[model samples]
Target: MEVSIIIVSYNCKSFVFECIDSIKKLTELITYEVIVVDNNSSDGIEDDVVIRYPDILFFKNDYNGGFGYANNIGLAHAKGKYVFFLNPDTLLLNNVCQTLYDYLELNNNVAALGCRVYDENLNNQMSYGKFPSVIQYLLEVFPVKWVSDNYKNKISSEGYLTEDLDLDVEFISGADLFVRKSVLDHIGGFDENFFLFFEEVDLCMRIKNAGYQIRITSQAKLIHLMGQTMQVSFQKFKWFEESRYVFLRKYYSKKFIVFSKSIFIFRYLFLWLKYLDKEWHKRAVFIYKLK
Candidate 1:
C-alpha cells in the first residue's frame, strides 16, 4: 500500500462516517487502506461502520485510550510506506492523499507533511507551527497589540499559517498529518504519554531531531470541523494542560520546566483573580496541584 489512512475515533460516529465517505469518494490515484481504531466510545460506531464499510479494518478497544495510544494500535497493523493520521472530523476537499504522497516521493528530506486545512466555511485553520517554548507561552499571555502582532509575524515567518506556498516547518498538525512509516518506526510512533494534545508536537520534535524535515503544503486541502470530536470543556482543558506539562517535561531542562510551570501557575492565578471565574480558579488549583 502507498498509504495507510488511520483514524482514531471517540464518541463521534457521524463525523467518522462522513470522514470515511469523503475519503472513499475523493481519494484516487493512490493505493491506500483505511484503518479505524475506536477508543471504546459508547456510540454504536463499530456496528454502523462495519456494516457500512466492510473493507475498512476496524478495531475496538475495551477502554478509552488517548489519541496516541489508539493510533499506535493502527500503526502496528499498517502495511504502507506512509501513514496518514487523519482526524475523524475532517473531510477531504481534494485528492489529499495523492498530493501528500507525491510531495514526499519527490522530497526525500521531508519525513512528515500536512496539507492546507480549512474550517467548514473555508477559512484557513492553523495546520503547522514552531515547537512550543516558554517564551512563546509568555508572549501569549501579554495583552499588548504590537506584542501580539510581532508574535503573529514570528509564527508566519516560522511557517505556522501559510496559505499560498509549500514550506518546511517545525511541526505539522495531527489533524491531517502525513508521515513516512520509517520515521515513525525510528521514533517509536506517537508518545503514548501524551493523553490528548501535543503528541504530534512531540513526534515532530523527535523526527526533526532525527534529521528529517517536517512540512506543510497548499497543493491539497481538507475541511476540519474543529473541536467536533473533542468539545471545549473543563475536562478538555484539563487534558490539554496535562499534555502540555508532559511535553515540556520531556523536551525541556529542569530549569525550563520549573520556569514554565511557574509562569503557568501565575497566569492561571491572574486569570482567576481578574475574571473571578470559578473555572479559572479551578484551573489554577488544578495546575498548582498537578505535580
Candidate 2:
C-alpha cells in the first residue's frame, strides 16, 4: 500500500463523513487504506463509518484514549509505506495525498511531511513554526500581542517559518502530517505520553534529532477546521501550565524544569486573574456569593 491514512476521531460525527469522503476519492495514484480510530465517540461514529464505508477499517476504543495514543493504536495496524496522522475535521485538497507520497519517495531524507493548511474560510493557517522558547511564549501574551500582530512581525505573521515555501521546519502540526513508515519504525510512533497537543512537534523534533528532514510541503494544501475535537477549551489556557511541565519532565533537565515551571505558574496566575475579571466570571462569582 502507498499510504495508511489514520484519523483519530473523538465526538465529531458532526463532520467525519465529509473528511472520509474526500479521502475515499483519493483512490487513484495513492493506493491507500483508511484507518479511523474512534475514541469512543457517543455520536454514532462507529456505525457511521461502517454503514458508509463498510470496507473501510474502523476501530472504536472502549474509552477515550488521547489523540496520540489512538494514532499509535492505528499505526500499529497500518500497512502502508507511508502513514498519515490526520484529524477527523480535516479535508484533503486535490491530489495532496499522491503529492506527499511522491515527494517523500524522491527525497529519501525527509522523514515526515506536513502540507499548507487553511482555515475554514480558506485563509492560510500556519502549519509549522520555530521551536517554542520561554521568551517567545511570554511575548505572545498581553503587551506583546499588539506588537506581534502589527506591522507583520516576522515571527507572528510568519507563524512558524511558512515564508520559506517548501523548507525543513522544527515542528509541524500533527493535524495533517505524512510520514514514511520506515522512519516511524526507526523512532517509533508518536510519544504516547502526550495525551493530545504537541505530539507532532515532539515527533518532528525526535526525527530531526535523528538526522531526518521534517518538511512542510507548500504545494499541497489541506483545510483544517481547527479545534473541532476539543471541548472545554478555555481549559486550553491551562495546557501550557500542565503540558509544559509534562514536556519539561520528558525532554528538559531538572534545572530547566524548575525554571519552566515557575514561568508556567506565573502565566497561569495571570490567566486566572484575567478569567476572574470576565463577565462570565462575575456571574459565577455572584452565584457563589448567593450560595
Candidate 3:
C-alpha cells in the first residue's frame, strides 16, 4: 500500500463517520488503507462504522489505551510506506493524502508533513508550531493572559501568518500528520508514556533528533472539529496536566520539573481564588495530588 491512514477513535461515532466519508469522496487517486482503532468505545461505534465500511481495517481495543497506544496498535498492522495519523473529528477539504504522499516521496529528508487546519466555521487553527518548553509553559499560564498570548503566538500555531508555503516547524498537531513508516519505526512510534496531550510533540522531538525534518505545507487543507470527542471537564484538564508533566519528566531536566510543579501549585491555587468556584478548587486539588 502507498499510505496507511490510522484514526484512533473513542466515542465519537458521528464525527468519525463524517471524516471517513469525506476521505472516500475526496481522495480519488491515492492508494491508501484506513485503519480505525476503537479505544473501547461504548457508543456502538463498531456497529455504526465497521458494519458500514467493511473494506476498512478495524481493530476494537479491549481497553482504553489512550491516543498513542491505540495508534501504535494500528501502526503494527499498517503495510503502507507512509502512515497518516488523523483525528476522527477532522474532515479533509481535499485529497490531502495524495498531496502529502507525493511530497514525501519527492523529498526524502522530510520525515513528516502537517497541512493547514481550519475549524468548521472556516477559522484557521494553529496546527503547526514549536515544541513546548519549560519557559513556554510558564508564560502560558501567567496571571495576565496577554503576556501568555505574546509568548504562545511565537511558538503555537497561528494560521493567520502564511508567509511561507513550505515551513519547517518543530511539531504538528497529531490531528492531521502524514509520516513515513521508516521514520516512525526508527523512532519507535509515539511514546506510550504520553496518555493524551503532548504525544505529538514528543514524537516530533524524536523525529528531529534522528535528523529528520518535520514541515508544514499550505498545499492541502482540512477542517478540524477541535475537542469533538472529549469534553472539557476537570477530568480532561487533569489528563492534560498529567501528560504534560510526563513529557517534561522524559525530556527536560529534573530542575525544570521541580520549577514547573511549583508553578502549577501556585497557579491552581490562584485560579481557585480568582474564580472562587468549586470547579476551580477541584482542579487545584487534582493537580496537588500529582505532587
Residue-by-residue lDDT tens digits, candidate 2, 13-50: 76778888887775466688889898888898776678
| Collision pairs in model 1 | none
Q: Candidate 1 lDDT (Cα, whole model)?
A: 0.88
Task: Write candidate 1's Cα lDDT for 226-257 as tens digits.
Answer: 88787689999899889988987888888887
Ranking by TM-score: 1, 3, 2
RMSD each, Å: 1.7, 5.1, 2.1
List the pairs of residues colliding in candidate 2.
129-160
Q: Return whichever of 1 and 3 wins on TM-score.
A: 1
Count of backbone collisions in candidate 2: 1
Residues 175-226 of candidate 3: C-alpha lDDT, one tens digit per residue: 9989999888888998888889889988988999999999988888899999
153, model 1: CA deviation in Å?
4.3
C-alpha lDDT of all candidate models, in order: 0.88, 0.75, 0.85
Sort order, lDDT high to low: 1, 3, 2
User: How far out, in Å, is residue 3 in model 3?
Assistant: 0.6
